[model samples]
Target: MRDRPQSDTRERIITAADRLFREIGYQKTTVADIARTLGMSPANVYRFFSSKKAINEAVTARCTAEIRMRLEAVAASGRPAAERMRALLLTAHQSVLELGVTDAKMQEMIAVAMAESWGVIRAHIEEVDAIITRVLRDGVASGEFVPSDPEVTGPCIRAAMMRFCHPGLLTQCHDIPRPTVEQQADFILSALGHHARS
Candidate 1:
């Protein structure tokens, strides 16, 4: 079909851009570099992505997709809210750490995302919040947690876990070693009114 090549070309562009970002950092990698790597013209790259920012957004979305899928799986599971919430938090933290964002070049890309293409990062955070909200609502319905406003708690919980979840902060705070991921997840669960079994 005609659509398959276009999809493949777009994926190829995203793949090349991600590689360059890992090799040379996001601030330094150019569309021309991506095109050169693909043996395609800059105009062809533009046809798929209108600008370098577009390419950067695509690459970022691709990188974060795996983490999102992991979180989504935990959210959609049929476990009790308290257990699901704990698993979701743990999954979120572990998945982000596994993403290798602390690497110098990956950190550079994250820094650029924070500065230039914040919408992409914000979308990811929003997705996380939505998953948390879904779990919290189920927790309330199941009587596993107290009735509370998920909208308020969702982002609050996410902010509380930012040190573990945020790529940039994760690297900076890894050395302090005070509140481990397990402790934080338990703290957040307790704060949500989950009483651990004896």
Candidate 2:
């Protein structure tokens, strides 16, 4: 019989790692723990990933990919740029809030991911910036936004929404009377000249 494909094995490893990370926190989860979950030796898992860090990166990628799918859908929708922008931010903030509120362990995992600057997390941020850039670019083309450099403007939007976008901040602000996503979106829209700025 042929052996399992490498991709299949790798995905299995990532899936198991994600569960363990959610259960035990990234700091406590081990390669051996992941291997045991798969009923394999740590050496076998190593054939697919070099270190525990790699496993964590894969898990992080998986989580962020889910968020990207939603953002991409919002970007591709036919709604007006202003509505799309609002949807994008709301979708992003909601994803993190849903995950954080539903899974308490996820916040711990996010803290570790942030502390280590995981490759997947960095890539996720860049992709998110790209999505924002796409919306801003379209808005400018449609005369809904003031013309500006999307490269510059996208990061600015990300920075302005940092409180709503950052996972750690989202969790901490859960109890506070923070601005709603719509309110933040309106401020961003105003800055984009969606309304007259005095």
CA lDDT of each candidate?
0.89, 0.85
- Supply the global lDDT for candidate 1: 0.89
Residue lDDT tens for model 1, 1-198: 576998999999999998899999887888999999999999999999999888888888987787889989999988788889999999998888877888999998878777888888889989889999999999988888888899999999999999998898998998998899988999998888996655
How many backbone clashes are present in model 1? 0
Best of the candidates, TM-score = 1
42-64: candidate 2 lDDT, tens digit per residue: 99999999988777777777778
**TM-score for each predicted model, relative to the true structure:** 0.93, 0.89
User: Over 4 Å off in model 1, which ranges?
Assistant: 1-3
Off by over 4 Å in 2: 1-4, 101-104, 196-198
**What TM-score, to 2 decimals, does candidate 2 have?**
0.89
